[model samples]
Target: MKWFEIALVVLTLGSGLVLLLDKLFLAKRRATKGGLLDSEEPALVDYSRAFFPVLAVVLVLRSFIAEPYKIPSSSMMPNLLIGDFILVNKFAYGIRLPITNTKVIPTGEPRRGDVVVFQFPGHPDMPGDPQRGENFIKRVIGLPGDRIGFHGDTLSINGQPLAYEVKGEYVGKGRGAEMNGATLLSEALPGRTHTVLEYLGRANPAGQGDWQVPQGQYLVMGDNRDNSDDGRFWGFLPEQNLRGKAFLIWLNCSGWFCKDGFEPSRIGSGIQ
Candidate 1:
C-alpha cells in the first residue's frame, strides 16, 4: 500500500481509539467524584479527535472518489507531461476496495480512445500483488476481441487504415528534446482525436502483422509511438487490472524530470 494510504488508515484508527478512550475516561470519572482528577494527568483524548471528521472525509474522497497521481514518464506526452500531477477518477471504472484493488461495485467500462490508468500486464513492478499499486497511463487502442495492426508507422484497425494527418516536425522542450526532430501527427480514433509523435527513422521490431486482443483484455499504446514500451512490448492489458480514467491535470512541477522548472499552462486541462 502507498504511504499516504497507510497514514490515512493509521490516522482514522488513531482518531477512533481516541474517541473511544475519551468516552471511557469520561464514564469512569462520572462514576466517582474524584476519580483520576484533572490534576493527576493530562487530557486522555489527544487533539487528533478534533480532526477525525476531516481525516475521514479526506480518506474517503481519496480512496473512493478521486486520487492524485504523478506522471513519471513521457509515454503520453503532448497530452500528459512528466511531472504533471493528475487526478484519476477512482470510481470512473469501478469502486474497488482501496489497497487490495478488488472491484466490488461496477461503475463503467473503458471505451476505445479513452486515456486510462491501469496496471501494466506482466510488468515487473506490477506483480500479482495488488498492494504494489503499479499503474501506467496510455490510450486504449484495441478493445477486447478487436484486431489492431501497425504497418511501418501507420495504424490500421479491423482492416481499415486509420487517418493520420502530418503535423510537421516536433520540437521537444525538456528531456523530451531527445525527440526534437521526430515527426508529429494527428491520429483520429473512433470517438476521439489526439496528437502523436512518430520517430520515422526507428525500425519496427518484429511488427508486421495484426495484434489479436484477447477476451477481457485491451491493447494500449502510447502517444510517443517509437519510444513507448506498451502493448507491443508487454502484450494486452487485462480488464481486471484497470485502475481509473485519467481526467485532469491538477498541477505541474517540472522538477528534475524536465528542463523547464514549472509549466502553469498545463494545469486545469482535461486529459484527452
Candidate 2:
C-alpha cells in the first residue's frame, strides 16, 4: 500500500480508539454530573471531537515530511542491501498529497548521484509487486537531455567516462552467495563517491540502444551494475513516480533470521 493509504488506515483506527474511550469514560462522567442522558448525542460529539484532528495531522506529516521503507532486493547491493530499513525524505523532492500523489509544493529536483527510491512504472497493475511497483533504490546517473552509454562495463555519462578504481572482491550474503565472484570498486560520480560491484568476465553490452531522457524524467541505475535491472531494461523513472531520497540506513539485518546481528559499520551511514 502507498504510504498515504497506510497513514489513513492508522488514522482511522486511532480515531476509533479515541472515540470508544470517550464514550466509555467521558460519557459516564457527564451522566454522573446530572447531564442529559442522550446516548446518540455522545456518539456524534465523540467522533467529531476525537477523529478528524488526529487524522488531519497524520495526513499532513506523512504526505509532506518523511516516510520509512524497507529494502527488499539486492538491486542496490553494497550501497543498500536486503533487510535494510531506510528513511526517505518525502519533502526532499517536493510535497505531494497522500493517496492521489499530487504535488502541492515545489521543493527541489533530484540531482545526479542522489540515491532515490521510486515506484516502478513498468506494469501499473502490479503496483508494489516486488518485481513490479517494487520500490527501486538507484543512483541518478543520467539526467534529462543527457546521453549515456556503457563501454566494457564502464559507464559514460554525456560522453564522459566516470572514474572507477577496483577496491577488492565483494563477500556476498544469503542469496548473494552466487555473486561472491563480483568485484568491488569505488566509483566517483560527480561530487559523490560510492562503492559498486561488477561481475567478472561480463562484457558491457555495447551498441545497446541509447536514450534521450524526456522532460520531467531521469535515468537511474544500480550500484551493482550487472545485477540491477534499471533504465537499460525498464526505462526512465517519471518525476511523479519518485517517492523520495533515501538519506539514511536506520537498520541492517543479515536476513529474516537477524542472526548476523547489527552491522556497526553500516549504522548511521548516509546514502549517496
Candidate 3:
C-alpha cells in the first residue's frame, strides 16, 4: 500500500474504534459511577466523534469512486503535462479494496488507446526483488493475446502498421520546454487517435522491439516516445497492477519556486 492509503486507513479505523468503544463501554461505565460526569465525553472520544464521519466519507469516495493524482514527469507529454492534477476513476476497471487492492467487483477492462495509471511492474530501486513499484501513467497500446511491435518511431499492432500523420514541430512551455524541437504526430491506434512526440532525427535503438502480449498482461507506452522509460525498456504490465483510468486534469501548477505557477487554462480539461 502507498503511504497515504495506509495513513488514511489507520486514521479512519482508529477514530471509528475510539467512538464505538466510548459509546459501548466507557460511556456506560461513567454513567454507573454517580458523580463522575456521565454527560461529559472524554477528549479523545470527543475528537474521534467529530472526525470519524468526515474521514469515512473521504475514504469511501477516494477508494471506490475517484482519486486525484499529480503528473510529476513528462511520460504522457502533449496530453498529460508536468504538474497536471488528474483524476482517476477508481472503479473504471474494477472495485478494489483499499491497501490490499483485491478486486471485489468486476467493472470493465481497459480499451486500446486508454490512458491508465498503474503500479510500475519493475522495482527500479530494488532490482531483482519483485515488489510493486511506484504508480506510472501511460497509454494502453496492446491488449492480451496481441502482437505489438515498435521500430523507427512507428507502432504496429497485430501485424498491422498504424498510420502516423506528422503534425508539426512541438513547441513546449514551462517544464516541457526541453522537448521544444520534438516532432509532433497524430497516431491512429485502432479506434482512437492521439498526439505523440518523437525526436525525428534521433535513433531509439532501445525502444525498437516486438513482443507478444500474454493473456493476463498489457503493453503500454508513453506519448513522449523518445523520452519515456516505459514498457519498452521494462516488460509487459500485469493486469493486476492496474490502478484505474485517467480521465481529467482538474488542476496544474508549474512548481513551488516558480512565480505565477498556476496554469489556469489546463484546469477542468478532459484527458483524451
Could you give the C-alpha RMSD of every candidate to the true structure, in order shown? 3.4, 5.0, 2.0
Q: All models: lDDT?
A: 0.80, 0.77, 0.88
Give the clashing pairs for model 3: none
What TM-score does candidate 1 get on C-alpha atoms? 0.85
lDDT of 3 at 63: 93
Global local distance difference test of model 1: 0.80
Model 3 Cα lDDT, one tens digit per residue, 1-272: 38899899999999999988987988888878752573477888888988999999999999999999999888899888898999999999999998877889999999999999998888445577554567889999999999999988789999999999999999977877778989999999999999999988684898899999999899999999998888888888998888899999998887774453677889999988
Q: Which of 2 and 3 is ahead in TM-score?
A: 3
Which of 2 and 3 is the better model by lDDT? 3
Give per-residue lDDT, candidate 1, residue 132. 37
Which candidate comes out best when scored by TM-score?
3
Q: Per-residue lDDT for 1-272 in model 1, tens only?
A: 26777788788879878878767876476557555544443354546556888888988898889888898888887677778899999898889876667899999989998888876567555567452346788999999888899888888888888898989999866545667788888998887889998877574665445799999899999998877778877678888888888999988877665456577787899988
Worst 10 contiguous positions by lDDT, candidate 2: 123-132
> By lDDT, highest first, what's the ranking?
3, 1, 2
**Model 2 accuracy (lDDT, Cα):** 0.77
Q: Model 2 TM-score?
A: 0.78
| Candidate 1 residue pairs that clash | none
Please give me the total number of clashing residue pairs in predicted model 1: 0
Q: Which ranges of candidate 2 are over 4 A from the true structure?
A: 3-58, 123-134, 172-178, 204-209, 254-261
